[model samples]
Target: MITPRFSCSQNEESVVVKIYCPSVRASDIEINVDDTLFTVHINPYYLRLNFSQSLLEDDESSAQYDPSSGYLTVTLTKAEKGQVFKDLDLLSKLLAPRLTEPPPGNPIIEVLDSDDAADIQTDEDALVQATESLTLEQNEILEAAESDWQLKQEVPEPLSSLRTSPTDRYGFLDSYSGYFTHVEHTENEVNELGSEAETLPKSDRRKHRIEHEEKKWDEEYYLADYADGEHIQELLCWRHPHLQLPDVSYTPEEELAMLNLPRKEYLASPLQTRQLYLTLLTLLFAYAYESRTTQHDPTPESGWTLGILIPAFSALDPPPYTDKSTNDPSTFSIEEVISTFVASYRRSLAFPLYRSFALAESCRSDVASFLSKGRRMVLRCLLEMKYILDHHDVYYVYSKIWIDDFCVWIQANASDETLHQLGSLICSLKIPKADIGWDLEELEALVSNSEVGREADSDDESEDEVERMLPTPL
Candidate 1:
């Protein structure tokens, strides 16, 4: 079955989907609308979409086909009139299904009642009670300390609240709770650590380290290391030549056509999923690097680059992993996940940091090299994936299948030697002078002069001190 090309537009009361199916019979077209889902079937051409808001097949809803134009126009009424609909133009999101479960380890709140008497209590009442109780407690503490003008000391608890035993053995909930106990750290660093990190698996610790390192590089670092060079030639050689070539920018009509292209999800194995994510990281980094080097600026949105990377509309081509027995009509594919990684990164809070020099440097060689090395090297790419995954998006399924499994497998099977080799390899990687974009000789001379000046000042201070000590007799 062929999934037809389509486009969506919405007003306050209705959404219009225009599907392109050439030489189709109008009477043969069958349509189904169930709450948020909409499906269309006409012999060989099929299209399925899941909308954010529910749709109603009321009098306002209608379907029409223009045989000459090869367009099937289906109008869907909004469940609530005047309610605004969003993402009508984001066709990939519309094609993907909504998440069925909360992410692992999150609390699931069950709303048992909407209008019960217990639900009527306001926040102001709770705040007033809390304030009164705090005041009484403070009064008592002041009275006790009044005699000596100092509070009495008490014995420390045997264990910290943070160090209390975890409720689960998987350690996803409290993986890092015991980190400080076994390892020494400054009080402030320990205090700065947030509770949320402990809820994630231990494999994410490397991601946190990568984030921390990137934070240390500011505008000065970017200017010093990446912005000052003649980078276009290097970028062209480093990435694809096609990236440097100018192509006609997509018009609104063309963009809508690309957005609505028919696609399908692949039944990928765990190994294939891992390979897919690794490839995604490589592509995203290459895109970011190419943008920075050629454009001399970070790309705010990366979805447009997909056209240059892949042949136009080839993303919707039938994938190799299609299963005939369990095939579903939803238009999705591995390419869509790749596209989602780029789109999700744009939506992330850390999008601005997408082109950090540290990230590019890490991916410089390892992007392709890490693929053959299996889980250990793939973990490095996962650090990149961590930034792009954001909170929730299409890649969440891959996360559940591959990322979570890798985390568990690594926790059980990873040895100290593997970690040592990873660290050693990271340290061995050298940054070329051209890559740094800094004049090494000039920077070194400036540093040397500054140090010499500091030494002379120190000598003068010592001479003055000696003079002051001897001159008192005169």
Candidate 2:
């Protein structure tokens, strides 16, 4: 049977298998389930998976096909809950190659040209002698042998997998982990084997060799925390292209570009207020993109977080509360703003706390202490999610509760300048009136009790000082 292009993921109780077979149909599909065994057949291709030793419960399996997506999902109930499967796509294991041993013999070897044959006179004499005596078949064989050696050389076979031990099986994670490890290495290559390694014991040297080889294999791969902007464009912004900010592909640049204001030419014909909100959307996701556990570190490729790049709070404040001045909604609500934050937070975090921590710790040598630390920070970020849903409430939370604690919390992990930018960014976001409306009077009242309101109205000389004191992540 032909191989199937498929992927598998799991929840607490079931394994979901998604097979990509765009040309297949429900009429051609077949599934057989037994208590520990599962089988899926689509015409000429079929998969038989025995999960007796796995977490699978082996009963009440189910399948569904989405014709539009051309994918079939099969759900297999799990015997055990909360047990993580290191792998679920066992097709590769079942399909381990059955290699036939080569016949025992010393294979014939090709010889280099004899010194006498290299000479024109000797070669001409030999050719003439062969033409005079040998049959056409014999001459053809000789001529073919002579010509084969002179043709373009064949490429040598690639080296085998870099896996050094049985436990070090190869997979996508292995490749990506190796890349992150390579990027972290900053020592002089010469020095690694020079005076420093010379002093180490034999065991240390062997370990070093293993690490070097692993890095060699993974140096070509890079894993990202989120899918591209194109992934969700249809879901969120089919018509609103400006709202669909593209996820960053690999590059020499940091995430600051995503958060920064769009250039003048990039903003099409839109009201000033709309431009302000759209630019705010860019900053929100940009902040989310950079929130990865490793992004705070200063690397050669992407240096320190460029917090000081954002305009100061005073500069971002909308012109003195006016409905006539700007076509921005008269009433602003915070529901959409909070929803956006929640969505972005989830996108940035990518996985549940437990799952994320597990992935981080696993990817760490294969990402290690650095990645582990990053996940811990992510845990803290999860706590910040609760207070970020509504504007009026966010302003109050920031002014009263969060400013006092969350500001310091972020400062511990990021630069002081970054903390200020985050504060400004949250304050800068204003959800335009969609359905329900609140006027400037209500907007002022929503923030009136908070320090953000005070700082927004402060004199330029005192603005800087007051802005520093306005810590309301509460």
Candidate 3:
């Protein structure tokens, strides 16, 4: 299988999406396009891609596969000129076509039909509306690139506030940021409250404020946690080459040990287990990429059929209950063990992705294609769940949960023979890239002042709010 590598760009007239398939000639590829879907296939491999068609206009769309450059170029004329493509990474959100439901905010950005819009109230009104519409479209692009929900949740400019990095900027701050400004209120202010507040200690009065400061991920933790040989190190490092971590070859013996760990032990060593989940999940993703675009050759030494590699754990079956007696020795079963693994994995990684999904859900989604396989109910449940994330910025989080959950469920019910197929599927994913290059707004207040004491000047503070840009999650 070959992963389809691609890039996209757009102009006022058209949007161009290019699939980077090296050495692939015109005859070696197959392309399919419809009103709202884009599917690609390359011969008899497990290589395929289906994109949400909801993004495109039904006008003259063209696809050109060039053998010389190995780039599959698809040109979609914008339904409305100047309408921005909000999400070019449509493949990342791929899982299955969701049910006929609303996207996040459940608000359809009602784009008016050109023919029906002939009734212009006034030329000036039309121009103003058009300009506003264009601005809204640009905003949608920014929203897709940098999540508004995350923007509100994360410190607006943690890195810009830092006076240090390798570049002497984006240095470390409090892990749970915005920890200061804990000055005590006057006694009258405290006493203005009810007796519960009156009786409370001045220290305890700050509990709510203190709780807000306790954040999960920190710059230091990220620097320490996501490194070579760390769990899911391959996924993170490969995706974010900007991080410059050395290559990690996750071997079979190590993978087996992860799967074989007792439930209690697995739960106890969350880091090891988390790395295991992350590793497996990322490998699954990498396999998808490699299987579609390029790198279809497997090493003879490794016995892999394709370039993508599967874990030994993916191939092995959990041991059946051997110590069965009048009283079973273990309280947990193999099913429970696998479920727990999936649950903890979702807590941090999947949960974050689900937040995005939830937001998307509020807006209506495209009518799901008949080809999509996942259940509609499950997606809704995922969207509705309270999204408490550990690492908000890590990409490939959703696929890890969904793919891992799908495989784990199958593996639990499946026989050892089917394990080979599961393993093969895992090896078909392609390497993914990280979303860096985030817009960093300089926080003059936090950037210059380490301690939160003096109040920011009203005029200067007002300017800072406008200058504030979202940070890359730690």
Candidate 4:
């Protein structure tokens, strides 16, 4: 049965699902709503959707079909009125079944609304009025206690004080502005993919994504990016000297774009999952290294990288696991791994500063050889991913999901190649023009210096305060 094209929208009380299915008799339609799951069936078309919130089918629930337009519009009341529903237009995610068993629950924290804030303010005012009646001696004692408490509190790491001018309002550091241009385009290609996907049928979304992924790769672009090794040299040679990377926070719009990223879980055994993660790590390394070579900075394609790579992993949302036999012992195919790598690598070449065909034939051979090496080269790939994810703040989520676990796994399974050897091999294992420049020792020293500087400054402040408190010799 075809998954009919659909669109969803919501108001305070109800969700409107518009499905396009023509020539179906009204009597032939079957609509079922069980808690958060909704199913619609009409002879040749079927759709099952899972919503973030429970839905209610009551007297107010209605289905209207427009024979002229071949559209079926179903309106269902929300279980909790006035509750806002999110990601309604994300058809692919909505069609994906919930995990077989829910992930472990986290502690629930109550969010304070305006009324709660007002009540808290009233209590604070009362306490302030009561405190005003304290004697000067009591106030002094309280002040001293507060001072001690403040001193005991942990100090936050100091931001880089090296910038002579004020910090840029944008995310880029003042010093790095000359090195990189800060593009103000708020809409990233990834968020645009999610928005554009809303109108497509569930069946077509994956195909659309596959085609889109394929279009990102071009041999000429890759060779062009490969020819200029300056960015690659920079990546291989210099490490940022700051513990907290300068201005790593995403702008408000960028954060929203990230939050809007499509999230779909897939069914894979622990082993297959680890392999998938490893493959993703390698792809990430190529992307990080190539983006630096092509764009001089990786920030521009950050979301786009996630957009392409994540869909490859979650391309097919596993069906609801009702039967035990659905769990099969299988592994990710090499073709799939290579496809993911190509998808990631292609994106890095998409917006290059230049392109060269002089070595296209040789570059193709090099890419083929890189893939043929397989597990032989993954060690260096893993090391490269660790270096970038360790320092880069934006890809921290990937680090948590893939890189961190992969690191632990690598540690548990020691190989003949030491980390230093593998890291050095990463520089030599360049694909035509790809080499990484992350040094662990240099990064460690920078972090150490950052901490020591903070401690020295704190000690000096404490000493100055003590001297001021002491009596002056007259």
- Clash counts for all predictions: 3, 17, 44, 5
**lDDT of each residue in 174-237, candidate 2, tens digit only:** 1111211231244322122333321333344435533433343221121211112233232222
The 10-residue segment of model 4 with minimum total lDDT is: 170-179
Summarize candidate 1's per-residue lDDT along 160-226 as a digit string, tens digits: 2452444212211212133323212322121112343324333344344335434533444444433
Q: Provide TM-scores for the models.
A: 0.35, 0.22, 0.24, 0.32
Residue 163 in model 4: lDDT:
39
Error of 1 at 391 (Å): 31
lDDT of 2 at 378: 26
lDDT score for candidate 3 against the true structure: 0.32
Give a tens-digit lDDT track for model 4, residues 1-474. 877777788998899999889998988999999999999999899988888899999999999999999999999999999988765643445766665875666978887766688889999999999899999988987998987744346879998545353322111010111111221233333322343322333345556655654565455444434445455454444332211133222234322322232344544445544344434434444443443333424454443454334442222211111122213223333333333343334434443333222222223333333333333233333444444554544444344444444433332232323333323333333232231112323434565677789999999999999999999999
Displacement of residue 466 (Cα, Å) in model 3 is: 60
User: How do the residues 79-162 of candidate 3 rate in per-residue lDDT, one tens digit apiece?
Assistant: 567766543332323322333443565666876676755465577687788757777767776676676444434557555343
The 10-residue segment with the lowest total lDDT in model 2: 306-315
Give the lDDT of residue 262 in candidate 4. Answer: 31
User: What is the alpha-carbon lDDT for the whole of candidate 1?
Assistant: 0.47
lDDT: which is higher, 2 or 3?
A: 2
For model 4, state the Cα shift of residue 318 in Å.
Answer: 21
Pairs in steric clash, model 1: 263-332, 264-332, 265-332
